[model samples]
Target: MSDLSGIWVAIVTPFHNDATHSVDHAALRRLVQHLRQAEVTGLVALGSTGEAAALDDAEQDAVLDTVLDAAQGLPVIGGLAGNHVGHLHARLAHLNTLPLHAVLSPAPYYVRPSQAALVHHFQDLAERSHAPLVLYDIPYRTGVAMDLHTILTLAEHPHITGIKDCGGSLDKTQQLIADGRLQVLAGEDAQIFHNLCLGGAGAITAAAQTCPEGFMKMYGALREGQLKEARQWQHLLSPLIRALYAEPNPSVVKAVLANQGLVTTISRAPHLAASEEARRAATQVLDRVLREARHIGPESNR
Candidate 1:
């Protein structure tokens, strides 16, 4: 909706028992407040860190619905990623009934599809969804790398509003920006500054779920032509990102939040909870980040 610019957060779907198989609405409401106070531009519910794969269809709808309801004015993009195009279409159909800005769909995963197939899948999705669509290209997660030529090809569709490029290849990202008119947002938490410098849009980083203010500070500094400060802040966040992700993502992040008294540190099956040492490390990093983040002013994204 608002051109999908600036810092968008791929929010973690907080769970009660470290099992994201179900979402805790109260925790989500708290998260919504954090994101809003942090002044993040958008919210992506049930994204990777959200552990969408571990949840059911009902869980997905509930998560999206609750976040949109809690956000009030903030734009909410339904995170509708699955390995099957058919299932994605179904989910998009469901989200169409809600008040959302767009459909944040990750590229189809497993048994790698060709770029031609990918283009078709996305175009088909665009045609079917009530909301605009943003493509998510994270080859690491999907195990299928999308070439620049193919990305440019998909961007040609007017219905395709933007993309969350998580491939971690700056050269490829640069080429896409150079060749297309697509709104390109960085998906990797570590590349927000570099992405803006390379002419890309903002970030929908998972880490932003907790460090929205700090990330926005880096974004603000970069936008003001202050790379020196931007780099400094980014350096400060680098360790936090690494340590939080040392375990299976939301697991560690959730645990850190729980320790900090924000939400329950829960994860579903296939993902384990963080170790005590990891929890301690994550907490230490989070405390320092929260302190430094305060200097940025949008209130800590607790």
Candidate 2:
């Protein structure tokens, strides 16, 4: 498989307008171009940040197609957040037909299956998946955490190649790094810097959508052991990350993107638009981050 290292953005789905709220393929293509310019390693479609939950299967497929087309040659990872093993197996069967780099699958949410059941669930999906899998361990949203033992056990599968580590347990993160069996990518935006310093492979960060250049620069610096430069960039980016999540997910994110005229600030129901204060804060922080990120080029080139 190709190395799943470096930065990947959890792309937000763009809507046509608040009235119809239909998927805006044109805007999505433009957004993809914007991130590609930042030189992100990959793009993730239908993830949490992409509002996967809000989209129906057909809508999701259309969104994925648009992204795949816009991504040019960049690998695009599709999100799989199903609770039913049978359904997911079937879903993976269908996804296998597409040319995706990998699928990001989280533990079945709300159901909170046992550790043993978790193993069975993932194994079943991996068996059905033609592509490699990136295990997602976000307990806060998923309602179930994969124990270290369970994760280690899953790592034995050839197809279960990596993890998006949002389990929020320091010990688990460290142990995974020490094992060196699976590629560990930081799932949370705030932890990206700390995870990298501890030898994480990369991050599937939502905050990167706002300041892709800065995030890429930080990753480049960390990979090259440029701790001081990476630290400075992370510190500057911390505020924007905080503000982006100040509201639920893409709320503040869409607001910031809209402010920059990248996409509309229209989000589906259950997720309101970001507060004016949050938008102002994110925009202000973005301004500063973009200015600094321009200077953080590839360390090897530097």
Candidate 3:
């Protein structure tokens, strides 16, 4: 097992034409290659950005394979998400045979469980998982928040490694960092610098999917102690973030990648594609950020 101890991306799954859920292996390779050139530390495959929930198990496996192959040597994290312990267990079992660094699981959604139930779920998963576990605490989607208390307890499990916290609450993040039980990775692209301030390791950003050079520069600026520069970059990227998420996720992000000629302009149906208007908005934002780059990043990384 390897470490997921820095900025990583919950990659949007690139698709083959026909606008289906099938993996476009060549495009997937290019996306992963882009991350390498941009210097992201790792990748979370089949996560929400990848629309893992919408894919069947076989499709999810194919995506993971493509991700692992494209990753070269960087760590690959498989998203094995569900409300059912049985389904999660079966997924983990299938993954036990792979070379993934870890498996990420968000607790059951729609029906919010008590902290005790959440604890039990992680305990059961931690006990069986061959790789280390990453707790995903995106309450917006899961309708369940794995608070620091529950997470601190889970961290005691040998299999529990760290977290991908999208709850967007700094107080909860500080508590976990203060408690020293788990490492917290920033799940928001817009707040990478702020998270790094509170002992956060780095980001798992949506924007990084399309603008990795800009994203890695955010981290580089912070790491190199250029807080003023990092702050400027954060403020500059704010427009892009707003535009990218102005509509549904993956769609806008995938569309941005497609514009950059990195990925397909395709996504599963019922999931909307970015309209020309949305693309125009995002382009304007990216343009402003690029023009303002000298005020944001390290000269070398720039």
Best by TM-score: 2
Cand. 1 Cα-lDDT: 0.81
lDDT string, candidate 3, 1-302, tens digits: 34666678889888878735477888988999888777788888988888887788998888888889888888888888887777878988999989988888888888899999999988898888888888889899999888767888888887788888788788888887777667778787776777887767777777876677777777777787887777777777788988998888888888888888988878887687788888888878887777877655455344
Kindly report which residue stretches of model 2 are placed more than 4 angstroms away from their true locations once superposed: 292-302
Please say which candidate is ahead in TM-score: 1 or 2: 2
Candidate 2, poorest ten consecutive residues by summed lDDT: 293-302
What lDDT does candidate 1 reach at residue 214?
82
**Distance from true position, residue 246, model 1, in Å?**
1.1
1 in model 2: Cα distance from truth in Å?
A: 2.9
Stretches of candidate 1 off by over 4 Å are: 18-21, 292-302
In model 2, pairs of residues that clash are none
Instruction: Judge candidate 2 against the unseen true structure and give its global Cα lDDT, from 0 to 1.
Output: 0.89
Q: How many steric overlaps are in each model, in order? A: 4, 0, 0
List, residue by residue over 70-111, the lDDT tens digit for candidate 1. 899899888887776677777788888998888888778886
Candidate 2 on 81-113: residue-level lDDT in tens? 978777777777778989999999998889999
Candidate 3, residue 88: Cα displacement in angstroms equals: 1.1
